[model samples]
Target: MAEEKDAAEALVTDLQKKITDAFDVFDHESNKTVDVREIGTIIRSLGCCPTEGELHEMLAEMEEEEPTGYIRFDKFLPTMTKVLLERRYRPISDDIILRAFEVLDENKKGYLTRDELVKYMTEEGEPFTQEEMEEMISAAVDPDKNIVPYKDYAAMMVIDD
Candidate 1:
């Protein structure tokens, strides 16, 4: 039990690091706060295409307040990793992935469109090629694509016990 607890804590720490790294990549100015656009860019980088609406939905999950429309660096980054890993690592369940998708989809829409993906990328100041955005959307939402909806996008993700 003690070992398991240690492992879990370690996983969380590693996940924090990943979030930090990802933020570094997305936060061009390095001031910390990630605006809606930055969030969109990061999603695109992760190989997922989100519609503008969907990008808003994902940001909603991390929003600490309203109007300001910003995700504080400390809260948003850590929570994203925690929520993402919890969903991915549960081998016995798709509940986590399903729920996350639901959240990102916002409007409870079943799928995200290319326009949304472009919106997110543009906001981040890092735009994706049409081909790249399409490929990412396919990975995340296309029933035919299987890159996501896995235990983790990759094994490098930190998992909780």
Candidate 2:
């Protein structure tokens, strides 16, 4: 237990340093924070192509904690940690995928219907086009059930393939 706790703390420190360095590159104003517009580029630099709505969502989430329109390095730590983790660990586990599905499954439904996915993806930040949503659903949804199960969603994101 001690070893595990130590490792976790070390990992958090490493992530914090990495995030600070990444944000520092864009902190030209020396204010230790980046404007909302620069967030997309910073995230992209870290290798995540977040959609416009996703960026907005991230900002809104950050705002909830700090109530500031700008993104301070400390406040953006969680977003940076997620991006770093996703990059370092590709082909996330089924459990992680299921958790993500749960976020979109507002009604606590075990499976995601086409309309539910469409609404979740379109109603929020950047609206996904019909074609894009269909493609995403078709790729993951089971043909027989016409719904996306946790397993199928995990399969769609398998990095090994």
Q: 1-92 in candidate 1: lDDT tens per residue?
A: 99999998898788777677777776666788766567766655443444666566767777766647566777676657755565531332
Which residue pairs in model 2 clash with each other?
A: 53-126
lDDT of the candidates, in the order given: 0.59, 0.73
Pick out the ten consecutive residues of candidate 2 with the lowest summed lDDT: 85-94
In terms of lDDT, the poorest run of 10 residues in model 1 is 150-159
RMSD (CA, Å), candidate 1 to true, equals 11.0
Candidate 1 vs. true structure, TM-score: 0.48
